[model samples]
Target: MERTRRSTIRSLAALGAAGLAGCLDGGLVGSVRERGGDGDESDESGDGDAPDEGRGPPTADGSRHLAYDLETLREESLSGGVGTDGIPSVENPTFVRIDEPTLIDDVPVFGVARGGEAKAYPQYVLVHHEIVNDVVGGDPVAVTYCPLTGTAQGFERGGTTFGVSGQLVNSNLIMYDRATGSWWPQMLATGIDGPMRGGTLREFRVVWTTLGEWRAAHPDSLIMTDETGYARRYENDPYGLYAPLGGYYADEETLFPPLSDPEEGHPKSVVVGARTADGAVAFDKASLLVERVLSGTLRPSDEPVIAVADPALSTGYVYLNPKNVTVEPDGDGYRVGGDGVGGAAESEGAVDADDLPLERVLAFDAMWFAWAGFYPETGFVGDHTGAGYGR
Candidate 1:
């Protein structure tokens, strides 16, 4: 029976809604004593305090507001059926410099450029193992991806590592820090359960782009290899392909019901989302790239911000524009500051889209449904409603 299941995943052209849950099965997990159970790794108990910085993964100073009650999310969670560590994380990951002449140009990679250190984690490889624990720029970090939500994210792993909790909330991956057994949903990035409840992770940007584009931008970049010590086929994507946009990714139906049903936008359409202490906001990625710039405000607070597209990496960056500066696309970069904000004539300069003069807000790409599910109040900027932030 297991053999047939393995064959089905290995041979399927694209995954359907029903095949989503079973794709990670068919293989027995290794000894639990190796990594220990979720409880065995616990280092603290729930005390209504944040996890100690020295013992737990580093957390953000301020927690992002959650649209739902913590207890409500805990009750709504469902088991993914792949017990803890079933989809293991890549610890002591191996990497090699990606030089020219490689045939893997079109492959998609999650590129992270931190403090001049550039490294990429391939989608095909991460599809088998959702998390890769490695050090980038001398900081222990965890690079994560969720196939169901089509989201990729980065977090600082101070003294400990993270693993899959074998659970799903709003069709997103639930990551548990080994130090406190805190469950952090990838999209929310807040601890929903365990000793670290109410804690928020310090996040970094992970650019989603093709290998060829990344290599072109960062010539000295290194990419993770498929030597994760796990016995699995990395070539076969369990979900589907991103380039051709096939399989479960392109499907309109979600495997599980969403917590909040958004009235507008496709469930699978990609949106660049940002969250601050004030509130969360999302911009249509496709529109932002073409238009090169989109402006919106973080909810209730209504703090002004703008989304600038980086054509080089095929990603977008959100910047806080309290001054309401006008940022327009030049030849290849952006022209910022003029009589744009509040009708005030300000100093103008040319800057790269990724390196705007304003303060940048941490943002990442997420499926519309996942963003809406976790942040129902998120202000969406798209073609229908022109985001009139005075830009």
Candidate 2:
């Protein structure tokens, strides 16, 4: 009888609505709503207070505006199976040294290091729990992932925590702060709905590369383990496989309609997007492979930024151009400077390639449709000539 129930659940998972309902019934979906009243009333007091209104934010008008079009924000498009905290955030996560036998090298991982502490978050685990609230170098950070957009970014939490709002703005994760109950869209980094509306969060740099690449770059780094408090199928990816055919990743059609037109690159084309105070630019991953390195001054800003690709990992990174820095293929990894930057196993300290002295602007990998939807006027660089991924 137990085996029959498990089989039924898997079958429903493949069937959409019925699958979602089953997840809710099994308690896989968290139903915790905002405590207190409506999430309005300004939180300028900064005492981590909840509003005395109802759930959600005040209606948007000229006084309160969103970065994206309010009309395009389809509230009904939210993934209902997962409620607040349904996909739990790792509070006090454990990590293992890079050389630890538990982790395989080829699996993709999001790597972030600061001061001296480096940590790797595996995609397999992030596929289950999209947010991981952990502290590094004495700073509170939230590492987030949106499988739909293929984006992994880190943000400074400002003494607060973030949770999955179970909402998607343009198929991107919508995060809410536990303290203010404000809804923040992951890619936009702005609080769209709540007292914190129009406010932005500070972002940190996180490299999306293979575990082997990160391990080779930061030998002393720590890798997040599978010991999350929740019982999850860490090995099973609900979105399909990574290599060869990337499941939804390999599809050109977006799961939901985007605010921007899909006439540019294919919907799922992967691009390394960089944003500055002035403007934004996206470098096609496949184009970077052919060019090896692409760099130039992004319009609006005279300063230059460079994009480099790691073909082996099918990942790329964007950095503010450093003085005399040229990214070239260096064995299994890419070197940022004339002075060789070795792999993590041989490196003495955290890999500084991703952290040049210049300010590391906020950048992330995104599906073309998602990035273009958020930044329609964004300038695109690179040859986009190949067949492109997903399609």
Candidate 3:
């Protein structure tokens, strides 16, 4: 997947937190007061109905440890100014092929492929709606993006859709399940203030890459269209831009204060992170794109995990490398052979960066601040920031 070179764009405009939040504050607060109210509902009780086992999204056997307790998280939650459902989820999203004129090569998009079905959710379109409740490869899924935290993720939605809860904690979007009505912080995915408390939702990887890179890798993919029922300025971004970097994305300030603050790197520096029930690891995305391979260890156990860059998609993949197999850059692919793993120590062959002979851990791109706020003790590996690979 040879991707086209992307020209970085400069910040188109400077916006303060007040200005940014103002764009959304109370705008359409009532028209959509339709769902949960301003998230200020006096329900600190977490008594939302416990839906039938299979009626909600699939839950993980275990979840990445949260640094804070449920009560503390609830205490930290705040409104994003918009009322519930204010930022609507696209219930009946429509997608089109590459033939669409707006599907340009350098445009940003989040790519997800499953069961032979591939879809590209354009960042411009998603920033306006945040969550797109759609089916892919016949499986119900929710594709969500948070402008404030700079994260995009996918989740399995068994029998219910996810809607924005119009709340923020750690400066991350909080999502609520239409079925159990559980409040889930987008980055955490685990229920915090509802019946689903402590339950982690199943997640899928989302590649934050340019449209050209994705189409090159998945040419026959369908891309989200602005045909969404809502009318929005898909071309405008209230927080900031990314191509050249501008606005809140390039600034050091936060719209809402985070739960925890760590001064490791630029708050908005992008890191490709992967987390499991045991721990989390973050690889400086920029460094991986250049260095090709960055190594780190999970906390407490010192379990080794390596990240490999996929030049084709301008993204990276994390793998559990207990054997510490040697993975080196080979043209656009990678070579894995060492410790008597993939092959003899002296033998090596090119393999796609996405598929090593080791266990692949789902990883996605996120801002450094947001990753640290949630996984405060996460292992970080990169020359772009401070430490390489623990609390």
Q: Candidate 2, residue 324: CA error in Å?
A: 14
| Residue-level lDDT tens digits of model 3 in 93-171 | 9888965655557778898888689999998888888999989888788999988778899977777889998777777
Model 2 C-alpha lDDT per residue in residues 45-120, reported as the tens digit of each score? 2233222333332222112112243323433235534667776778878887878846567688888877689888
- RMSD per model, one decimal: 8.7, 10.6, 10.2
lDDT of 1 by residue, 154-219 (tens): 987888899988787777888998988899888877777887777777778888888998999998
Q: By summed lDDT, which 10 consecutive residues of candidate 3 come out lowest?
A: 26-35
**Model 1 segments more than 4 A misplaced:** 1-54, 340-348, 383-391
Clash pairs detected, candidate 1:
none
Candidate lDDT (C-alpha), each: 0.74, 0.61, 0.71
Q: After superposition, how far is residue 211 of candidate 1 from its true place, in Å?
A: 0.3
Better of 1 and 3 by TM-score: 1
Candidate 3: stretches off by over 4 Å = 1-54, 340-348, 385-391
Pairs clashing in candidate 3? 8-244, 9-243, 9-244, 11-246, 380-389
Which whole-number lDDT from 0 to 100 does residue 108 have in model 3? 83
Sequence-dependent TM-score of model 2? 0.71
Candidate 1 has its poorest 10 consecutive residues by lDDT at: 34-43
